[model samples]
Target: MSDQPANLREQALEEAALWFASLQDEQVSEQERQAWQKWLAESVWHREAWAKVEQIDREFHQLPTQRSFQALQSAGRSRRQFLYGLAGAAVALPFAWHQRDILQAAWTPGTLHQTAVGERRQLALADGSQLWLNTNTLITVDERAARRQLFLLHGELYLQSAPETQALRINTDYGSVDMMNTELNIRLGNNSAHLAVTTGEARVQLAQDTTPVTVAKKESLAFNQTRSVLTEGISANDEAWRKGYLVAENMRLEDFLKALGRYHSQGWLKCSDAVANLRLIGHYPIADTRKVLDTLAQSLPVKVRHITPWFTLIEDNRNISHS
Candidate 1:
């Protein structure tokens, strides 16, 4: 409903983002919020921007906190010196370029930051830690005065803990991971969690047992409600996904499709039994599932049957008997 020109809308949106971020910060003062109202009353565009930013939050699931946005703005969104009228220009942001409209979630307390299917997001927390959220992930972060805590509710994440707080703790339903200047990957399944520590060490405590378990560098552990298995070999594939690729190292074809299905934009993706055990070896980009499916058909004796955007079935190309 905002008829403001694109440029004004963009500027309004930027300021709205700053206000949204500012309001959610526990450090925000009443005076600053009152100042936001003054700026809001200055123009219709400002109100529209605020509304738009709120709408974005409704869709995206979480807004970037100060720590989250500060680093992200430094990464992909080009920055320029911008002074805020809110807080009487007390805040400064390196906001000079147009940012993607979708990252507008305002980080509020206890909110879950999520990524849609087929989408990956990298977040830079205020504590200097970095987090890359895999597709269809849900996680919550709590950075209070004394320490920082992360909750991995579902899906996968690759995190490099900030040196400032090696004591940061991450909680999943299965247990908690206490980082010691760590770089790690975690994925939560229906009844289990898989953790891989690439560098540094972590102390894990499962829900069923208060006993702490140590996972050293290069070690991978998968645990459920009752048991845990410490193994190896995740060093390669897990790291590859952080770089936007799904690497299949002689992985089974059905398993490969299972991994790819996590990033499928819609519907179900499956392979027929005939090609279920076919071994696949390749590193395919995950940004486009359709492209990956097409590539899969080209590389092996498989036929990709894309009935619609929502239905995909891969069958044996060599079998000419069935439809």
Candidate 2:
């Protein structure tokens, strides 16, 4: 999960699964075997994926089928998709949800890191710390700068700072964070910023403020260009994208979709006014946005409709929806 392109890794994993399937087809041909060998020679990632499939197969065989099934029946994932090939015998393509997006900037020259929509990246810092850049994010890090500094140009990130190292300096368009040892998430949006502290403490200062506000563990702060508000009720799952899930706990359908929308760069995700306030609760996988949508339709009284490749509409399914 070090800065490799997630999409490429996913491609390798899916292809590995298909190759495994074809090889097990009983009618497997010599050409198929040759192609598999050729594919394995292509890259280390490909071989790693192939090895993962073999290891998972061994683990599955070692466990009781019912016991294994009981342990892994979360979120109703198809057997074909097992959180990056935990089910080796599955034939359908599975996503590499653990895959991390690539990084162009190692805080070297230029020092800019960006991830495409739906892509996520993890970076190890110079000070034995780490950070994760969320979807459609861009940031700048000055690795050579003493005490270390990072700028969130846009999008979101989670940082785990080393307690023994110098305090990290995290800058945003609207504010800045200074912390010695802390685990936190920072999100930047249009005229808005959000901070959630999971461990330790962070001292944040708005651009115009002379003094910094201290945010402690389990606390969060939300602000605009100027005004800011703090809260403690933010759930730990607020940052679940790192685990490749969009968790909803008795949340409004509208709000859930909006959060889910971040994982996609498509046109839009909309619900009719009639279902806007409906409640939904679940852990939705994000590797395939369409699967998440399909899951939503199964649990909620809603219909999923495709308007265009870029647009999706969620409508009431119980009756002809007018709203």
Best by lDDT: 2
In model 2, state the lDDT of residue 244: 84
Q: Candidate 2 — which residues are off by over 4 angstroms?
A: 1-110
Candidate 2, residue 306: the lDDT equals 63
- Per-model TM-score versus the true fold: 0.64, 0.65
Per-residue CA lDDT of model 1 for 1-323, tens digit only, reads 33556566557766676566546545556778778989899998788778765664443234334433332322221111221212121112223211211233234334568876678899998878899998767777878636678877657899998785648888877888889689999988756899999998888888888678888899999987567888865557678887889988899987888778777664446566678899988788989878988888888898776543333567777752211
The true-versus-predicted C-alpha distance at residue 30 of model 2, in Å, is 59
Q: List where candidate 1 sits over 4 angstroms from the true fold.
A: 1-111, 320-323
Error of 2 at 322 (Å): 2.9
lDDT of 1 at 173: 70
lDDT of 2 by residue, 99-217 (tens): 11123234333377877667889998877898999877778888786667888876789999976888888888788888878999998765679999988999888888776788999
What clash count does candidate 1 reach? 4
